[model samples]
Target: MQETLFCLRVGHRLPYSMSYSNTTDFTNPSTFILLGIPGLEAAHVWLSIPFCTMYVAAVLGNFTILFIVKREPRLHAPMYYFICMLAITDLVLSTSMLPKMLSIFWFNSREIDFSACLTQMYFIHCFSVMESGILVAMAFDRYIAICDPLKHSTTLANPMVAKIGLAVVLRSAMLILPYPLLTRQWPYCKSNIIPDTHCMHIAVVKLACADTRISSYYGLFVLFCVKGLDMFFVALSYTQILRAIFRLPTKDARLKTFGTCSSHLFSILAFFIPALFSSLTYRFGQNVPLHFRVLIGNVNLLVPPMLNPITYGVRTKQIRDRLHQLFSHKDI
Candidate 1:
């Protein structure tokens, strides 16, 4: 969708407008005014340094994951394939929101056309949901490997893994496609200033000049279906994994199993805890500072993509060795 719209500005800015015309003449605002981060606009310059560092680190780290996974034929298994998918999701999600965020912070470029805002929200939410699914798939793979090793390769072969990845992407896109559409139809007669950096589903939806119960409930529904369900299954899979681990005969065997899962455990916590906390805080923490909420939001979005590759580098021997080899060659 092209964001280059010819807008006709009208009416004074109301923070929460609730007057929709009874007759139908649907026209969207030409541009949305994003406030970047309320109460911290003065520090946007200082903010950009860290945000830029995060963006650079996230891009470089995820690219390294992609490079290593693609370069080494030996790493072309289902596990790495899933990790690669993870890297892709992280890359896309971060890229979708952050650049504009940085532009807002650094350049005061906050006017996003209605279509562009909707497009950004769609990818951000879709990739976020897709990420949860990828994590679920990773947990399932670990479950089968640890609990049913004899059937691991056959069950999650190349074809099966490919299909699983495809299904996850498709499922997320199908479910989340309605989100942008729902908000797109809303009348934005009031203030278009989003409190945060980017166009989140709720942030955009909240701008509607109507009773937004349906959109709000629908957003909650998508959240439950995406993050809620994925986390439930992941927790379930880990419960079984722990049960299987304790049943191992040797102490060393159990420790070894723990070692195998430590990276994934760390990655899961790194991604989910901050994200869950951020969302919950926004939803429930009435006293939390808007700037604080915005900080957590940035961490939840940027940190996982930045850390996933680092986790692989520290835990996976193949990735570590490959990094060493590449750097060593570069030095020469």
Candidate 2:
């Protein structure tokens, strides 16, 4: 069955109006109008408040994690290194969309340059893929530490960590490179108005006059290859970690060991669950309200960045201790 395309008309209050004519050769409009949550424009102001707060929190939290990790000698380990990478990825992922989205909500600054939109699309998806890979790396770090304590240091040396980081970067960049390239080639003559806040891949590509099956299929392929493989490895690592924890000599030892993994487990759930749900909902939930769908999309990107640092700060003893010491010294 062919996917049904829904064309949204810009409301009268929008600064720029959209033309839904049947023309097929416009290729690239100079600017694409972003309609921030169709049918809920009136609440845009109120909505911006929470969105802005989350963006601010995300920035501050991630930067704090990076600062603490960098300043403390004890944190110069494989796990902390991966944590820093995750923080950076979260920052990029949230920053890519929140500012522009806040502008749309607060000032009606909804017009995005075509090329710029594609660039934003690329960054958002690319970093999201990187985040997934980093999560897997973090999980591997946990597995090595718990299951193979004696060789953990030798197995995940600085050189090995560098290699893992390089692989994650190259993998995401190479896989998501095709999205903008493929999207740019299509003729977007159908409409210049995107129904949601950001230039999501499908949302942007669907506007093109040409068949979008190629982009859609490639998207699925990347989704499976990156996120799918990452999830599988993470699950396998944790499974082994769990078995090791159980075989420990005593109950207290089991609890103590599991505590170390609790933070990573929380971060994984926080990152992937909403992300997968939002993507699936956007693609298949035809009966879902536009506002609800858009809100989920924003939440997946916004919430994880803000939540990850907080989760680590509270759960990781070393980070919490460093945070306390750093602040206490300032108070003196």
Candidate 3:
């Protein structure tokens, strides 16, 4: 009991603890403490309601979309397949973010082992970039479907969709694998109290005693290559899509064409807007309240997954028809 007490107290101090701090070189720390949204400790119970709601909705929403798409013959198109990939990414993202966060908010269970923390960071980042890639692919799908409607089937055939899916997965895994490994190589000496809800790459990297410039720069490089390139292509594709939409002779044709993109546009905005905002806030909003920063940081993870499926089900006619057939005991 005494030994356990000693370890807990020491582990709470992390690499800064006396025994661990004596040497600059270190193997691993006892544990990392995740501070769940600073200044919200008193309201953790109340805050967990929304977190739990979002988590459940995210899981259900994504899985429902996946099931409907997979089971229905009408949804076998490349667009739906890309959406399935997105559903999978949403599953991973919500799984990566919510479990530990809920545990912290509900049970005050904050301590995480070193290997687990690294693993969590790996999945979180990998899925995030993969989702970004899928969004870009979705944009291309929209562009082809709208601008080159006659060639849509040929352009995004099953083989092409499979290749894109494989590429997205491989790219994400390759880019994000180094992040956890980099953090693993660096020794933590200051503290292990990560002032965030989950094991984020930046949060963990910032705790290392070693020079983090390489890791930081490498992160930024990956960020620009994956998300930056994705956004650029998406913007370009939409530019072409808009150009095609306006060229249509009838006003009804323009509205019909524009309506087809509403779901994807909503999805892009939901995922990217909060994500970029939170990242900027994290980097530059030093004066911002920690709780506020934490909330914004988490918004993208929760909101997009819950909303994306609902948006598509409501906006896209094929999905809506398929869903209605599924629930109403009719054929799609």
Best by TM-score: 2
Supply the global lDDT for candidate 2: 0.88
lDDT of 2 at 307: 95
Q: On lDDT, who's better, 1 or 3?
A: 3
lDDT of 3 by residue, 1-332 (tens): 33234335423323334434423445577677787877677788898899889889888888889998988887899989988999889988888978899898888888888899999889988998999999999999999999888999988899999999999999999999999888988888666667788888877888788899988888878777778888899999999999999999999999998999989998998988787777667666889887898888787788888898889889989888878887899754
Superposition TM-score, candidate 3 onto the true structure: 0.91
Give the lDDT of residue 242 in candidate 2.
99
Sorted on TM-score, highest at the top, how do the candidates line up? 2, 3, 1
Deviation in angstroms for 264 in model 3?
A: 0.3
RMSD of each: 5.8, 3.2, 4.1
Task: Estimate the TM-score of every prediction.
Answer: 0.90, 0.94, 0.91
lDDT, residue 56, model 2: 93
Q: Which of candidates 1 and 2 reaches a greater lDDT?
A: 2
- Cα lDDT over the full model 3: 0.83
- Comparing 1 and 3 on TM-score, the stronger one: 3
